[model samples]
Target: MLNRIIQQFGLQVQSINEVEDSHSSTVYKCTLSSGENVFLKIPYTKLKYQRELEAYEILKGRVSIPDMLEYWTGDEDCPGAFLLSELKGKPLTSKGSPTVAFQVGVLQAKMHTIHPPAEKVLNGIRNEYTNWSHFIENQFYSFAKDVEDVLPPQLYKRAIEKFEEMKHQLPPPDGPSFVHMDFRPANIIVDNNKVSGIIDFESVRFGSTEMDFTKLYRDFLCLDTTLYESYREGYNSIRTLIDLEEVLPFYQFTDAFNSIGWCKRRGMEKNALFLEENVSIIKNFIL
Candidate 1:
């Protein structure tokens, strides 16, 4: 199929290599004869194919994202839609550094400046809670059943109960900003110690800037005060003061459950001790 696409585009395919395999799709790097590289995302579902294409088109030069070359639905005759864009840099996790983190912070702050069409924004948030406390409560309750065995029985029950009791004590959501809902390190690409591109827009939606920042807090800082402060300092270089207190509890709760899901999917329970620490943090800090 890729060979057919290369031929159709009148471009020579120098090499093709599988980059990453996600539950949704298989990503590949295709080098063309012109010396330019393109990233091709092939999803298993037609819906995901359309969503990713829409996201790429919506974000196109507005932000530093992969440029879409072509999209076509695959069929018994065709196969699957092929997303082709200029191959960016390596993922951040593969090249960890403070400079890359700072660049990521700046890029994210810039992305927030783009407001999606107002109607789309409203529709996205229509049924979603705009209050921080309620947001935390709702996500916890929704995932509680799946995470029961991951947490201590007593702590899990207490956390849920505390969330119920304290629902009204939290602050309202801040002004809505464009949120890269899954802005973790793995989704960002860095080159020469700087963020060159960001990928994985499956969860892009209008929401609080905190939603993006929380991923940094969980995956990068992990409760390290100095690192957290450093990230905030980098972020503030582009934006203004941001109070994260209201979002901290939500971050803790979501990070715990997210880790459980990640571990289960990856079959890495050998790190059960690491998961135990996450639960402990949720109990002491979030509960």
Candidate 2:
């Protein structure tokens, strides 16, 4: 069916090999008959497809995102596929060097400058969060509900109590900045110690700038003091750094709660270590 989609585009493909990355999409590395390389991504859900398509449409040339050569939404015959220019690098593996972190910081701060489409422009994007506290409150309660069976009863009760207390202290972010909701090392592409591309926009949203930092903090920033400061320096080069001390813990706790709910939904056994780590984070907040 996807092959037929390619045929419909009049794109003569030399080969298509699977790239195992996203859980919700079947991604492929394809070589064109014209000797160019591209990715063929067919997302499982239409919502995922729409988000990604709109993201690429908005973010082309402004940032280091994969170029969307062409895309076709699926009909009853087949699911949609995005034929994107093959971004030239692999996903980041380790906690990157100070240089890499700095570049990532600079890029992220720049990305936040591009505001998401207005509500009238984008009708059904679920992530176009208008009110900052409202978005957090909704996610907190929603994920909390999901994790009730996953977390210990005592911890679950405390999570509810802790969230109510913390909700009042939620910081007002610098305006409605465009956010890459899953900004992590895995979604970053590096080549020659520089960030070449940022991928995975299915989770892109309009929200607080700080919301983007939680995952980076979890996966990258906490690993080393030098890296954190370097990242701060780079971000500050664009805009003043927010008071992370005031904001990080609140978002971190919520991030951890979201992870627990996610692990339970996906399955707890294979994600045992991740679940344990997030549970520990919850413990720190509620203890």
Task: Name the top lDDT candidate.
Answer: 2
Clashes of each: 3, 0
Q: Write the per-residue lDDT of candidate 1 for residues 1-287, one digit (tens) a residue.
A: 66665565566778889875344577778787788788667676655665566567667777788767777667664535565675356666623666666676677777777665554433222223255455556656666766676666887777666656554544565446667767877777777776777787655555566556766676775545655666667778877636777766656666666566455544646757756766676667554
For candidate 2, give the lDDT: 0.82
TM-score of 2: 0.90
Error of 1 at 2 (Å): 7.4
Candidate 2 structure quality by residue, lDDT tens digits, 1-287? 76687786788889988886465678888888899988888887777788888788788878899888788878975557788887677787665899988998888988888876665366324544567788888877777777998887988988888888887887666657778888988888898788898988877777778788898888888989999999999988987778888888888989999889888887899889999999999998778
Alpha-carbon error at 82 in model 2, in Å?
A: 0.5
Q: Which pairs clash in model 1?
A: 74-79, 74-80, 75-79
Best by TM-score: 2
Off by over 4 Å in 1: 1-14, 21-24, 33-35, 44-47, 74-82, 94-98, 119-138, 165-169, 221-230, 262-277, 283-287
